[model samples]
Target: MQATRVLLELAGNVVLLLWGLHMVQSGLTRALGGDLRRILGAGLRNRWTAFLSGMGITMLLQSSTATGLMATGFTANGLVSLMPALAVMLGANVGSTLIVQVLAFDVTHVAPVLLLGGFLAFRRGGRTRSRDLGRVAIGLGLMLLSLHLLVATIAPAENAPMLRRMLGMLTADPVVAVLLAAILSWAAHSSVAAILLIASLAGGGVIGPEAAVAMVAGANLGSAINPIVEGPGGDGHNPAARRLPVGNLVNRIAGCLIVLPLLGPITAGLQTLSPDATRLAANFHLAFNLAMAALFIGPLPWFARVLTRLFPERVAVADPGMPLYLDRSALRVPHLAIANAAREALRMADAVDSMLRGALDVLHSDDRKRVQEIRRMDDVLDRLHDAIKHYLTQINVEDLDERDARRVSDVLTFTINLEHVGDIVDRNLMEAASKKIRRKLRFSTEGAAEIAGMLERLSETQRLAAAVFVSGDIRSARALMREKEVIRDLETSATEAHFARLRAGRTESVETSALHLDILRDLRRINAHLVAAAYPVLDQSGELLPSRLKHGATHG
Candidate 1:
């Protein structure tokens, strides 16, 4: 009964540690996620910078798995090259160990201070960023408290015969120790937590240094596995997308295989670095990764070439109308599901953009084929919007926090707007183009130029709307609204100019009068659909006016 109680307490402490780590990860992701993405994007220029960027981001996030996901997503999207992504993974490994280095010391005294300050900030802070930072502080405090409790619980069991016998077996066979730690770390989805537990046992003298070192190797291997299993491009359908995760796991496996045979020498060397068992285990974890980084960083380009050959990008023969990022597995994780939905939403925007560009071509060329093509593209948008709506609705709303819930609504709104934009291009503008083609009608030169100008601006607004959808920046959203005004002015001027042409009895204007006006109206309507993406963002920031009416003025 006593042993069972000890095991249960140990498990509970580990749970608390995992929870704290989760809070830290989720908070930092919300607070600095965009900045980190920009920083990571900028840093991927070369291997050295990519390595440092990966380490810095993982350190901030406190989860290399999260860093891996970001890196993998960038690779899958063609945003960055595989070589630099591999370098980032190496840096992330080193960064994850730095957290262990800090926690290896006795820092339990600051827990209450952190908890008190964090609680006050979370309750009293007005800004979202402040609240997120407060959450980070609270997570840090919980982590320290859990570690303190873990040590206190384990200290009394140091001499328990059952505990000693179990640990003795682990110390006797380092292979079993490594495998056990790997399983625990994988199940927890956190090497940081797993290693902390192992270190605590070593510090408590319940396990020897060799067993702890073996377990550290296992923890490293285990953490790398989660990304390949659960990340964005992890489905085997896209081998190119799995390159970064698989490469990262390869490094971990190599490091473990190399260290296992040299356990005695490695543990002895680690002991020389730190006399305390906990610090010794932590040092080994750091040194192992640093060595891996040194050995692998330079050959990343060549290693990338090898991985590419092994997992060449397959020609996508699948229907383009099918959803790309909406993995059913991600629905269990609300944030991941949100990200998947966002990516799929972007696809809708992409189709709309193509339709806008094609609309300009059809209006100028009177191409029958282009009109048919634009209509087909509208079908793609409808399918994507439907898929996104169904996928998002499948996510349990009870599982979403305020931020995640807001993200879902934003993605749905953006996709719906894009779908409407597609309708304007296909049903209105394309139909007008088809009428002109069928009747052998042409626009007056002045009217053609005006229609082209509006179409150009519509395309620009679509791009801005996409940017707003992804970044949610208030300034960008405001700028998108400004473009809406510009488009409205263009439409009004085009209407007046068309009236002037009609009054002058311009032959081409008289011939295609209705078609020219329809084109102008449809272009303006499409602009409105594109601009709808910004309204929600501006409203949330309190930058949007409730209405354009004067104060207390009634609308009949």
Candidate 2:
């Protein structure tokens, strides 16, 4: 019963530590999420930049695993190359050890002050920034307090006969000790928590310096395990994205393997720097990650190439089926998330473009099989449109600047328009073509030429809208807006000409009069949808007006 009570206390302390770490991670993510992404995205110029940025982000986040996950998502999306990403992970590994290093010192007295200050600041919040900063403060305070609790809880274990016996065995067999620590670290989901516990055990003199060093190595290796589980699945998942987590695991295991045999010498050497057992263990963690980072940072390109060979891209993977850049992990960073959404919007436009081309194909050939296939393409557009909408909505607009908010609105408007265009093709134009084919009706040669010309023009307009969406260039957007007026004029003239042909006693024109007019109306509406992508850009530049007509003044 006494042992059970003691174990319960230990469990509570560990839970407290984990909760504190969670608060810090969540707080920082909400407070400076966009800036963090911008920094990460902008810093990937080379391996050195990647490494430094990784370290900087990890220090701010206080979790290497989160940094690794974000980087993995980027790699999966092809935003950052594997070599630069690996360099950042190296830096993150080093940065993740900072918590343990800080804990080895005596800062327990500051916890109450931090807790009070954090609570007050959090209560005073007007936006997420202040609240998130308070959250970090509270988490850091809890961490320091938990460290004190951890040492006190473990100190009594030295007098327990059963616990003492277990420690004796772990000290005698470093391999067994490491495996035990590694498993616990993975289960706990926080290396900082595991390392803090080990450091406390060292402080209590329940474990020697050598065993603590071995345990620290195991803890670091286990740190990479979470990323492995979080990565893309083996099947129906992104091959490139899975590599970051796997590669991170590889780095940890390899570093531990090399250092395991040298534990006796390394621990002995580190002992000279500190007679305190806890500091010795902390130093070993800092040393091990730094060495591994320096050793692997340069060869990351070769490493990435090898990983790609191992997980080759699937030959069957096609566009319009999977999202190219709409990564949920990116939502924390509004800028990257918006950029990803824009790319996905472009992909949706391409799918719509294909459907338009198919409608044109059905005009001359009337291939039932091909028309059916093209009609099904709208399903892909519908799914992608929903996906892009959900992704953009996940971004916290309250956290965004005016510029970013405008960018997000642009993406939303563009996807909505693309979806509308897709519906017009599937329900309106495809049906018209099917009816004409079913009745064995042939359009007059002039009508055929006119419809074909209009279809070709619509396709060109779609291509321009796609470019404008991605580039957000003012000139291109204005051109797209102008093209809308051109499409309207063409539709009006085509309709008038159809009536003229009907009055001339052209049998083909009279026979297919309804289908020809219906097709022209739908095509004009589709053009209007495609041109909507430019409205945001044109509005922002003051080159376009909200309502294209004067309210008070009328034209004669």
lDDT of 1 by residue, 78-160 (tens): 88899999999999999999999998899999999988888888899898778878888999999999999999999988657
Give residue 539's error in model 1 in angstroms. 3.7
Tell me the whole-model lDDT of each prediction, alpha carbons only: 0.86, 0.82
**RMSD, candidate 1, Å:** 5.5
Instruction: State model 1's lDDT.
Output: 0.86
Candidate with top lDDT is: 1
Candidate 2 residue lDDT tens string, 1-556: 5556667888899999988887888778767766887788888889899989998899898888778767776677677788888888998888888767987798999999989888887889776578779988999899888888988888888777677666768666888778878887999888878988888888788788878988888898888886666446444666666677778889888887887899889988998888888888888889989999988887888998998888776676476667767766556556667878888888888888898888889998988888788878888888888888888888876546556778888888888888889889889888888898899999999999889999999999999999888887877887787787788999988999999999999999999999999999999999988888787777676666566622321212
Where is model 2 more than 4 Å wrong at Cα?
77-81, 112-134, 155-172, 236-243, 298-320, 326-342, 364-370, 382-420, 444-506, 524-556
Error of 2 at 34 (Å): 4.0
